[model samples]
Target chain A: MTRWGMVIDVGRCIGCQACTVACKVENLSPVDAWYAPVVEYEVGEYPDARMSYLPTLCNHCTDAPCVTACPSGALRRRDDGIVLADEDRCIGSRACMAACPYGALHLFEEASGEVLGDGSRGRPSLLEPYTAAGRIPGTVSKCTYCAHRIDFGTANGLMPGVDPLATPVCVVTCPAECRIFGDLDDPDSRVSRYTAERGPREVLRPDAQTGATTAYVGLS
Target chain B: MSAPVTAAPLPQNVFMDRWVLGPKTQRVWGLNHAIWFTLMGIGGGVFLVGRAFDVTTELGRVLGLPLVDVVSFVLIAIGGVVLIADLGRPLQAWRAFRNVKASWISWGAWADLVFLTFGGLLMLPDLEIGDSTPFSGLGWESEADGAGSVMLVLASIAAVVVMLYAGAVLARPRSIPYWHSVAVPFQFLASSLAMATATVLVLVVLDGDDVTSGQAVTLAVLSAALAVSMLLHLTTDKEAPGKKESIDRLVRGSSRTTFLFVSLLAGTALPALLALVAAAAGGARNALVVVALPLLVVGGFLLRLDTLKAGIYPPVTMPSVPARRTRG
Candidate 1:
């Protein structure tokens, strides 16, 4: 009954985009598609003006609108509360893209990987491990929270979010240590403790009533 | 002491179209979707009216097919094709058939398929195939009238569902301010009925069938409803954050030409006026039906296009507005 959740401490974020790069490289995501984008903006009037970064990603809602809207049942919620799209079953209707309030989901138009000059596809050795599981064109895709690494680590008797090898690339690579990912149901987990301390964290468009699991600290 | 307060500079990203949703962006369903909606709307509307009046007058057969059957079949068939073409993975389109719980598109796909297959079957009796053909006994005029009637009923129900389903799909995207209106679906229904009436008029003329007074009245009522729905859509209080901006875009911004001149003046008012005149002038003004019908139909399409193009996404970052009481 473990429910995976993300807690982003906006106060500690420096808008460095290291997590964005790490996520891109780890996922072999399209160059334009950033699974974790640090949105930098100025807030308040001139006298109180300050630059701030609010990083955003998939919320992985317990009541995901995308799952409900998906006609093919391609998008589904895992027992562990991770929302995923089954590529084989996807019809690419883009309904999930429309239903998502966070703008987290994206449609893969064309491959963004390296290609040789003579019309040949270039292979990246880092991405070779995920070749059988990479996204296909004409389908909607989003963050998976590094499910492969988590699964592999769990199989070898390691704890995700606690062990570096099992943690999401974004959380591990964030220089300012703004991101904390762990099971929300575990009272002893860091995320659970953080949630108890910062009881009124922010989730994007709470009015949408999607029951989003991703929460942001220092959002106000 | 409290810190001095001054006007904060507006966030640069607020004006940026990316990150913040606005004009000419955020079309999850685009031209193909609009086309499919239009075709299906017309087809369904035509079938409803055609059955209502029982207008079975046969125009001269082209390849042994009546004009009514040809038009309805083409509209629904092309709509089905366009719907399939809009999908990113057309090969996996069959997956839509696997689930029909909450998805309107899945229900629409099933309805479209049933309408096409059974509707084609219903047409078998009207066709002039030779007696030696194995399917000769299955014609509507033969022993198949009961079955044909049943198919027509089912197809008509399916067709009506298809018409409503198109609007529902567009309306359910809560993030888009322009699309999340009750008026939208009603506008679509009104336009569909008007377009179908206009199309039937054209077909009746082609079939050399005399235009009836009751048909004229029906067209008039539908046109009025269409006009009111358009007004309702434009004037409703859209309290969603960016909805007012979206409405402004349609009424006075980039989409004004089509919304005002085409959809309003040329499309709605002109047709309504002509239909009224024809109703007043009695049988003498049947020629006006020719001109008015095409205008009404084109106007119906323009209304849809305008509505589709006017859909603007609600801005991701909500803007700060100071509260003040003002006497209305």
Candidate 2:
């Protein structure tokens, strides 16, 4: 009964992108891939208009369309609610990309552009040495929710939402303390507590019926 | 270490359409999809029509292969090649067969293979080329007759799947409101049949054969159906956020080609009207039927092209920011 989830206080987010940078450093994501990107938009008109920063990442929905649309069996959702794509099994059909509602998926399209050149650093983009499924060109990728960290930390007797090592870097790195992560199944967990006390159950696009683990607060 | 990523701010002006987090047009499938869908539909359509009309056996070949069967097979083969080439990893394209139970594209892949294999074997012993004269086939013709019936049945099933599969693929992404309709698959099937029927009509005309009273009526009905399907597809999803924008995109935006050609002239009206006239004219070889046949096919292609262009990504709802943040 350990369903991993994250909640964001939209009002507190300062759009500093520290978490965005941390994700890149931690995950070694492919070039042009924003596993966690804060999308900035100007909402409302004139006097009522305000700049809004919506931090977007993979929702890791319980009923994920990408997992279903994957013809090559590349995308899979774990029992803990973490969804990740198998780089080796992917056929680069782009079906998962079209299927994803959050646009979480990214394809490392070309080896020449994504790889580090000059032969000194013989690498095809950055590698996630933690997971057996390494990065490759023409395969899709997305936020792993730092599953490697959560796995290591929990196996060694650490709570994910409470432990810096176990929590997602986006939550750990946010300067404004905008994000919270915990086991949603545990009613006493921070994510659960926050939702019960203050957080709105409405995730983005509640219409999609994605059963998205990520929820938000401070919306009209 | 990965490169330090730059922040991408949404263009303020472009948001004029919806103002908040706006709909993004899906950029994944484009001209390649259009080509694949159109050709595949036409191919499948031709196979269905040719079989339904029982032209496979009546039309003869020196090598014992009917032209209709061979043409349909080649068209689908070309479509399959184009689709595979468009994939990011064409080298591992064979891996598409891994998930036939879930993915429509996988269904298409398997369907294409079966259609080609069974359809290839099913291509008939037909008449001499350029004339109605039935040619006696080579020695094994008598032995091939029984198995050909079973092959025909299998290929027909595969052909129907091929015609419907791409639309099913588009419809699976529920976030894309424009494509998330039963109407899309319906429209795809309709236009596919129309295109296939039009192709058959064109072939019949070119072969100096009289336009059959049955075929002319079928063309009129299918042509009208294509138009009606387009209208239903555009009208029914009026309430969805992306759908209005999709309509605009089709009518005036990048997909105007579809509105002007497919919806208005080629695919629908001209063909429908002319087919009716030709049918009324007692299947006469007329200039209008000749002109409308190609246009009918073009409209079908345009529908596929424009529908892809018009696919608007569902706009994400902005969390209601407090009043203090609204100042421009």
Q: DockQ of each model against the real complex?
A: 0.29, 0.42
Deviation of model 1 at A105, angstroms:
1.7
lDDT of 2 by residue, B215-307 (tens): 788888988887777777777857667788998888767667666666557667788888888888873545557777678777877888888
lDDT per residue for candidate 1 within B117-147, as digits (tens), equals 8777776655665633345466465323677
Question: What's the residue-level lDDT of B70 in candidate 1?
Answer: 69
Fnat of candidate 2 is: 0.52
Tens digit of lDDT per residue, candidate 1, span A1-220?
8888888888899888898789888987753467777776677789988777777788898888888788898899999888987877888899888777777887765444444445566665423433455666678888888888788888998888899898888999999988988888898888878867865566666556677778777666
Q: True contacts preserved, each candidate?
A: 0.38, 0.52
lDDT at B244, model 1: 77
Clashes of each: 3, 8
Candidate 2 docking quality: incorrect, acceptable, medium or high: acceptable
Per-prediction interface RMSD in Å: 7.5, 7.2
- In candidate 2, the residue pairs with backbone N, CA or C atoms under 3 Å apart (3 or more residues apart, or in different chains) clash, namely A48-B326, A49-B326, A219-B320, A220-B320, B59-B126, B59-B127, B60-B126, B60-B127
Worst 10 residues of 2 chain A by lDDT: A124-133
